[model samples]
Target: MNYVLYAVPFFFLLIGLELLADRWRKVSTYRLADAINSLSAGVLSTTVGLLTKVVGLLTYTFAWQHWGVFELSAQNLWVWLFAFVFYDFCYYWNHRLGHERNVLWAAHSVHHQSEEYNLSTALRQTSTGWIFGWVFYLPMALVGVPPLVFLTVAALNLLYQFWVHTRHIPKLGWFEWVFISPSNHRVHHAQNAVYMDRNYGGVFIVWDRLFGTFQEELDEEPVVFGVTTPLASWNPLWANLQFYVVLWRDAVLAESWWDKLRIWFMRTGWRPADVAAKYPQSKADLSQFVKFHVPLRPAQQLYAGLQFVLYVAAGSFLLATGANQSVAVLLGSCAWMAFGLYVLGLWLENRPQALGLEVLRLLLNAPALWLAEQAGLLPISTLGWSLLGLYSLASALALVLVARRGSAALPA
Candidate 1:
């Protein structure tokens, strides 16, 4: 039923509320570029999922049709109840292994790249998780859980996790004992020595407690957010690929064929001895850890924010109608969206060439829009085209003015 689609407005509404709470408490829980980067990663993930989701669905459907032990009916109440619990049980392992292995961590690390713990952080997800994530849920298919029931329960499990990625919520007494609460989840995100690799649960805390991976959030050791190795850029594409690039480089440098192959599946931080000796990687000292930031003028910030709003509007439209689109239209839209985001990342970093790239993007947008309309993928009247042309011209003019004024940098 596309529950995630229906929940989009509420997600932004809650993010707004969290911002209000931060203002009231005089606690800055969100940085403009960081939050935007987080949201960009999420948008990219969703767009990519549209193309890759079929891989998981096909495997699950095949398993269910060919190897079912019982004919599970979604109409049955017990099926719903059991599926909810079972899905989370599977999710617990999926999430745990995501942190414990190198290749899996390469995909999952995008979520931990955010230095701040806010509602926006929850939306930060991976585009590459579909590579192995489907393997964890095969038990559900084998047990005869229908595809509809599995999807519904999986969505519910994800929706339940959204509110837990916050710093304002305090630990609830008995509620912390059973369900996955905000406090425990915060520990799961921490890279502190005591908190690393702990509390790997989705909706229920029972899995972690039973599996001996639970760690209580301690007042003595205040939680420090983010991964041990910082993703020091605001680029969403880079966030998803940084660890993978690192691993690939290490694999290339390794002398032995076995070392080259095994390095990808080894423990999360394991590195080949020869590679490690030649190219040392520095881990952040938590005591003096600093969050990544890039300076931007107020006008640039406003411009980036406005451009992001436009991207979100475009992304929402794509999500709503993308499935019905022709392959050419869908791929074209996805490419345009990705290019806009890549340029946004460049702009946020204050690269001198950002305006040029953005100019190029705007110049291309007109033809892209016209082509979509010509192909019947989009229905735009003359007035609509005129408005878009005007927007492009206006944005170019604004970029020129912002560039001439000499970008004034303010500390983030």
Candidate 2:
């Protein structure tokens, strides 16, 4: 059975609940277009997943060969439970390490790039974590957990996390102790000092409770979400890479080699003394911060909301149909990508002009789909891996153009 096929309906359920909550309780968790854009990114990520799995399989099979052991089955329930919990335990460590180590942090930070916390934020997953992510769960197989069980449980764990992304639910008293509740999960998303590096549970919240890394959501200071070194831009790729790129620049600019070595392994945001001394505190005064203007025009909202429904329906179809090779698959992909870029433009408008470069990026990726076709990259494979290096390079240059336009507009 194609488990991911259900993500379409789940996407709709999330959006509908968000809307219903907004009307009934005035707790509007997402703007329509932003939601669509987020959903589109998720669709694109799954499109990317088809490629990543090939890498995952090769790595897993190679490990098994090196150990001279291979066992596969769908008949074991106890092993599934074991792998399920075991993966969460490993994930807790991987996730916790992601917040602590700068290199790991770089790969994981993209998920926290969104300032407006909502269901959309949940869909904002990292694309690069696959590189080291699988290594963390290898112990499950060594313990003899079936591969099918591992895959299924991981999916279930992910599905369980989806509902926690919303702000609609208030704190559940005792439920907060055993399962990852909205309150505890909200604290995990926060950028505040108290909330930082806490709550690393996946399926069960008990892991956090036992690990001494748990932090409660207090009513005093409301959580200010997103990474401390904020991306503050709309380009999803840039969001994924900004921290690592910054860390790299700092490491290269360091006078001593030890400083370079210390940067990646130390706690994230840790800087060398010399490097910190040269360029000191240039903090923006938050009181002077102007709120981003969504404007929320009635017509604009309607347009965005409508686009959200239409593009999601279209993307969902693409996801379900075409079991790897089919003609005209780009139809759903283009509509979805366009929606992503369009909503990104909406949020980008409120940010610094420097952030709008994402528009060019959105424009740049369209050709990869075409190029994939012309090059006969997959023969009959229409859309499994349409956008690759070409698409990314084009998007980067497109963003550069948007940045250039903005720079030119400023008066000397």
Report the number of the highest-TM-score candidate: 1
Q: Local error of candidate 2 at 390, Å?
A: 28
Of candidate 2, the 10-residue stretch with the lowest lDDT total is: 284-293
| Residue-wise C-alpha lDDT for candidate 1, range 249-330, written one tens digit per residue | 9999999999999999999999999999999988778999888889888888988998898877777777777767777776
The Cα local distance difference test for each model comes to 0.91, 0.66
Error of 1 at 14 (Å): 0.5
**Could you give the C-alpha RMSD of every candidate to the true structure, in order shown?**
2.1, 7.3
Q: What TM-score number comes out for model 1?
A: 0.97
Instruction: Give lDDT tens digits, candidate 2, residues 1-412.
Output: 4566786577567767787878898665665544544564565566555446556656655555455244645576665666778889988998998888888898888777666677777887776778778888776666555556767787888877877887778899989888898888999988777788899898778888898999999998677766667665555546556887989988998998998988988888888888889866464443344323354334334433543454455446555644463344454454445545455544433455424444543454456455545644334253444534554565466555545664676699
Off by over 4 Å in 1: 407-412
Which pairs of residues collide in candidate 1?
none
